[model samples]
Target: MTRSAPRSQAAELELPGLVRDRVREGRAKAAATRARRHAEAEIAEESPVARVLVDVPLAHLDRPFDYAVPVAMAADARPGVRVKVRFAGQDVDGFLLARTTQTTHQGRLQPLRRVVSAEPVLSPKIADLAAEVAERYAGTRADVLRLAVPPRHATTEKEPSPPAGPAEPWTVSVAASAWAGHDPAEAYLHHLADGGSPRAVWQAAAGSVWPLLLAHAVAATAASGRGALVVVPDGKDVARLDAALRQVLGEGRHVALTADAGPARRYRDFLAVSRGAVKVAVGTRAAAFAPVHDLGLVALWDDGDDALAEPRAPYPHAREVLLLRAEREGAAALVGGFARTVEADHLVRAGWAHQIRPTRALARERLTVAIAGASDFDLERDPFARVSRVPREAHETIRAGVATGPVLLQTPRRGYAAALACETCRAPARCGACRGPLHLTGATTPPECGWCGRVEEAWTCAACGGRGLRAPVLGDARTAEELGRIFPGVPVVTSSGERVRASVPDRPAIVVATPGAEPVAERGYAAVLLLDTWLLLGRPDLRTDEEALRRWSNAVGLVRPGGRALAVGDPALPALQALLRWDQPGFARREAEARAEAHLPPASRLATITGEAGAVDDALTLLALPAGGEVLGPVPHEGGRDSEEWRAVVRAPRAHATALSSALGELQRVRSARKLDPVRVQVDPPSL
Candidate 1:
């Protein structure tokens, strides 16, 4: 027994030595592996740390972060290429902003997980532009990057389709344009041709060939061995500018970069611009950011169109982006439209741009305008129309004008009926399920929610418990139906919503359409009836008058030179007067003056803070408002009783715009830190 005990003790001692040996061996192997990893990292030390703006999309994490470049991935992790990294414990994609040896981050930087692409999707100029835009609009850099660079399509990058030549050759002379004689216009063109960035804000007579004028300017820029970019509002304007640019720059000089061109085609065109294949770019709003090389001129037509305001976050208007690009790139800018808005007028007023006016004689020669007053119509000519909504003068003008060509009737609304309201108390009817405002798409169809698409058959108004509904404002369909009954033999064609006709044959027809949906007549419309003018101007919006004038002029501009337009409203309003006398600039200047007096936009900067009532109130309390800034709300956001949402408006003088923006941005940063309820922040919203 004693001998066995000695052996057990010896065995136990040997077990401890064996365990220590195994532990030492494991430690040695781990140290060797770490040493090899350190050696590899040292080899990659030559590559700078990449400052990547990860696609986290959270407003709080919008800034750039430092990432260590590995030797294997350093070649492909160049600035502007998409890279994947471990962020918040998950691998995610990001855009490399810059590569630098120095970083401000205090923590140990994580290695870039992998390189996603080496295509340089973002350019240095675009990075700078996006940053400036983010600062200007109080948006995140990541948001703007999402807009500046499209998603990468591997197939599109691998192989591109053969470029197609223009269907016909284009060779229009710039000097033969309608505005050749205007000294300011001539000087602007000469400046572009001389490689100078002279800004011009041109106002053209409505019926004049304005697209041709723009094309001439673009051609002047292209003539100096530089590129030009022209951004319009929609596909129609894109087509017009595309056609005009083709006429001026010839085949293959420009590429249209609209999303409607399909992702592959758009990406191809973008690549073409990056490759210096095209010197001119024409498209919708997104084209304002087209990567045209050595951009000499940036022009936007009809900047007031709502389509010019991007629907995505950061929500930049094309005009603002173009303005910034022109400043940053030293590119000339042309901000012109049929009707001017306060923003454009502010540019001219501030002397940032010069006003380009056509000669009075030329304007008179090109535009013919008339007014149909409410009380001046002849009752004897057509009693039915006079007694009804349509005036006798409208009937007479349509009858006489149809002999020459088609007639356009512009209504304010688009549906079969105006939004339904309680017949008794005049309160707007709403859907029971979604609280969306109820609208009638047809006379017999049940009332449906415009937002939720819910049909509300058993709906009653909250106010007065009324069941009957009435349309306070007339709509295009109802107006068309009424007009069809009035003009029995005339072919009545309705154009609005999904069935918007781009152009009508030059024949006798009554074209009833909503605002922004007027069909172009081949030769020209014989006459235009600006119906429901009161509804247009009576809206409680800041840009109501401006929108009215823009719409009225756009419709009237489609009329033939000798034809007339009869507006069915008071003729004394400055907007109507502007149309009657072709005084858009004068009207815009006056509108700006009025807005300045009222402390509205253009003269002052405005921002809206909207969210849950408590959250909005708390945020406003934390705001560090600049001097001369006024806070004007906490009101119900939806203008309804029992509403939980609220809104606050901050107005600051033009001189304090920068301070105001900075303060708002700081407040947003603090809100993010506190993790407060989300609130939407918008600067200079098109509508108040």
Candidate 2:
């Protein structure tokens, strides 16, 4: 049998084991190739782990999330880039906060879906500021980021910054002149130049000189090789500051960042500042967070204007933001206005900031003020002629004052009739459909509901059955019309809202404008008529008197040194006296003292919680307030019809403010985690 088996039989017997070995070798090689491919892909992904802040905008999800960077997106997905990521189960947009080799998140991370742009729209400074702002305002960082950074313009971001221009040093003489008697302001400038962070509140005169003073401050900061940020209330302030900065700091040292300059242009200017191409940044409220490098000084013009308050969830005021920036960056702070705010006064009272003022005699010599209705003047004869909107004294003053320059008339409203009431019963006219108050936008436009925006042709008063309407608040247009008739052949111009003029010719024209819309005359206005003092002072707002004083002071600032201003209001009012005497510091001191006594803001901290009645009540109950804090309301919200929403206020001592903020933040987190209905929480709100 062995002989028959031969060589062929022996080879067949060894074939199974050899074939098995060959199959094992092939399988091993395939496994090795798969491992190598995986290692290569992971090296591409894991090397660049991006910490992205997804734009989910939830309080619970406020922090940055980690994402693995894909191979193709490694270059574009660098820090601060806008990118799209897979959050949860869907794609979401986010800002790439940073890149790191590791993440604390233990779970497997999702990869970035795609890169939106390589342009690092957000700088580290900006991201930090936004986060600080969000914390201070009790808001989600995502919301604050939305306000700090404008929408990304692909075309604009790719474009290069304009070439460098001639370098002309800004003059400091304006600063010296404006701060001549106000030693604190001068010292503030010196401190900035010496690279010291000095915080101050300057009660600068309202007119042309204030802009010059601000420009001087900026120039001083620039002298120290540092940057400056100037935030105002509106575009007009931007233009005014721009002109003054150019005059004092020379051309091309600063860029005006305003929304009025289309998005593309605004983003371009922003990029310039971010890239250190420019040193000075000037713009409206949002510009407080401008990406300025080595910021030396942060200044705000008319910080009390409502325009400075962000109209979004977790509202923040420009003044507070600047204050925060000053603290965070160790930069000098300058908060100046014609009239001082209680908050600013508090800073001086606390010794956190010093007040800069002109000598009483110097201030008196700079501007003259008179009370129109203070004296025993005939309502229908001497000061106020029948059917005439302008008082006779105002008319006379304008007649003589126009010889020197322009005369400014400041009105409270800016249409044919702002508010209407029944002629018989003095009941407000409202729309029949919505029961909203009616207003007249123009002489041609019928009475329209201010809330619902519907024409009330057949409207009837609820309190009175009468239909004849009378103007409760006479507007600028009507005032101009009546003035035009009174002063025949004299040119009358109106400025308000969209039609605001930046500057007026230094001629003998009668300029009528709404608050904050007054045009700067080449030479100061000859006379300023502060009309409708009652209308402004009679508002139910806490800052009514303060705001009125501010408006009056602003108008007074427009007048030449020897020129006069006539205010048509009760002279006995402390605010009116403050304006008449050019006593901003005294007013602020008194205001701060009074607010302290009343346990109001600037002395104490306040937070507002608003939402559906049940939600707000539930949230209030859940709050574990600090020892000195008090919760005051479950009251119906103002300006709502059949509103289910209610508001509750939390008042705390300034010392305990931090604790209160922390408690509120925790409450927000709990609610968010529990998936409960959201409540709107506003700390230091504009109106509240």
Candidate 3:
């Protein structure tokens, strides 16, 4: 048949239509390839072009939108560059993640309104770490992205700050090499030199020197010819550390980043780091994501600090942000705290981080500290918690400490945030649910329970019918008032919310403040007073033991070496005992063991799924996963407090956490394919 084919001269006259169609098909394929390459090159040439994936804060949507970049600004217009763009006919600040040759839009592409000045605000490494954090926390990428950048510049029309020149590179070294044997200051310095940055926890006992302790870490890291980032709890800490670091690194080698700086100044520091002018950065939570170059180490002074917890859209924890970044960038992480948080303990036990703990033997020999009424709450307790009452011994200690200098009093509540009510009606004279106290500060206001959305008619104490009720639990103001009575002549100043900071006291004074508001002892307090030890140690949260221990340690840490601090609880209650002996590492070890045995979250894994019942059901159907996984409530209840819809929760091993999360994410994509509902997904939710 092949040989005879040559004889088909007549058959060689093919149909004109078929021949033309073949030619057109080949030309179309060639044109399609040319179009794709052209689009990629055009985007590469102009705009801060990136397939920006942002979290709009909607419960049900998770995706990225492609945006074009202006050519002249493409140099600094790379991934993690915060940019201004129009979306849904409105302009918003978005982090430019990465440029892409693909797009999901058929509509005309929009160019970035302007680059947010590529001052390297969001480093490439941090950007990747942010995405990973979102994944580990079962949170949205946009959620973490939002965290990586500060509040978007207010206007689409704005001028960029003037540029700053880069500063010379810096180096680090310890002040006292002999200090390393058993003391934490030395231990931490040695830890840094050992390439221990990926993860390390520093647990120092009370009386353990920390400013000097952290200084050692900073110096060691700097000496390695790399960068270091340190984060403290608040302004007082920033001020204190700024002075300490300058002593070693000299002026202008480091920058202090706190919100206290005026807007222009803050922007200047932000740009300084962006321009590599500042090799070392220190600040509160926001500085954890600093964009320093060749970062070799990261440190957090206190891990349990609420200040480290960002309350914005993603709500990422700073301790965690640094932990994740350290691993990803191969940098050392030293979480230095007077007391250890259970979460840090978990990392240590799991071999994810080293427990840089000071020996109890060394701690015990330094200060003879003890909880006076260690076994009895009556010795030191708060009325609000219904624990043992505050004791006479603890009171006496404060009386004694105050004579030498300032007596630091730690309260459990601050601001108007703490309210009181009538115990008989189980309601305090409040503004019904707002929990605002129904006080006659001005006129005779009817007493009501701030909670329950109910107002009492002439709500007088049923027990006494006296329409007046004082705070059931005293706030910092009330505490200050009482301390005034307890020590009539001593000046009583408050250090609670609003009146948060305390100046260094030169004479005998009583500084009654809430936890977290305690000011740095400008001249160092002669003695510290712990009012409600049990109340803090026995709260209802999962991290209660951990939190209580931290607060106590921080309070005790303010004391001068020869000065003393006392906790009023059964010092035998492991946590209090740890306090008496100043044993944070041991306490952390015990807490870590308890957590792992419980198989509860942080030990295992958890995820929250919420959305339309149909979509949730679809996801559940796909997850016939292994036994390590468990799905909790899609039990169908009235959500939104009063809405008619339903929601559910799914918890599983962390190993399969992403699969379950993706199933949920894909369900979202599928649901979005048609319509969406008011569903929310939170992985490793900080709180339910």
Alpha-carbon shift of residue 347 in model 1 (angstroms): 1.2
Highest-TM-score candidate: 2
How well does candidate 3 score on lDDT at residue 533? Answer: 64
lDDT of 1 by residue, 560-623 (tens): 7667778887778888888888889899999999999999888898988989998899889999
User: Candidates' TM-scores?
Assistant: 0.86, 0.88, 0.76
Candidates ranked by TM-score, best first? 2, 1, 3
Off by over 4 Å in 3: 1-121, 151-174, 177-198, 260-262, 372-390, 415-459, 463-472, 570-572, 609-627, 634-649, 658-675
Per-residue error for 298 in candidate 2, Å, reads 0.8
What's the lDDT for all of these models?
Answer: 0.81, 0.82, 0.67
The 10-residue segment of model 1 with minimum total lDDT is 164-173
Clashing pairs in 2: 170-249, 383-392
Cα lDDT tens digits for candidate 3, 1-688: 4455453443544547787677678789999988755544465543333766554654245556787765645676777667778877788777776786666788878776667656446666777787676655545667776555555344311444333233334333334442443444454565566555546777765555576666666767777667888989888888878877776666677777877885656666666666676668898888887777778888898878777777664556788788877877888888878888777877777788766665656565445566765344332344443332345666787788788888787877664325556654546554534645553211244444444546556555545455545555555665676568878898988887677784556578888778887876666677787765656765656678878878878887777656777665555688888877777777877887787686656666666666567757765665454457777778564445554545676776657666765565555455545565435555555544
lDDT tens digits, residue span 1-688, model 2? 3455667556656679888677678889999988755643563544668899999867889899888876767777777789998887899889999988898888877777788988887998789988877877788888988888888888998888873356565445656776676656666877877778888888875444788788888888888889999999988788889998888777777899888899999889988887788879999999998988899999998878999999987688899989988988889989998889888888887899988877766776777888877453465443322222556777788888777788999998888788888877877787888888788877777799888889877766678688788786788998888788877877899999789888899888899999888998888888999887888877887787888888888878888777888887777889989888888778878888888898888788889999998899889988999989999987888857578888999989999887787788778878888888889999987775
After superposition, which runs of candidate 2 have C-alpha atoms over 4 Å from their true positions? 1-40, 44-48, 70-72, 170-174, 206-208, 374-389, 419-472, 639-641
Task: Work out how many backbone clashes candidate 1 has.
Answer: 0
What TM-score does model 2 achieve against the real structure? 0.88
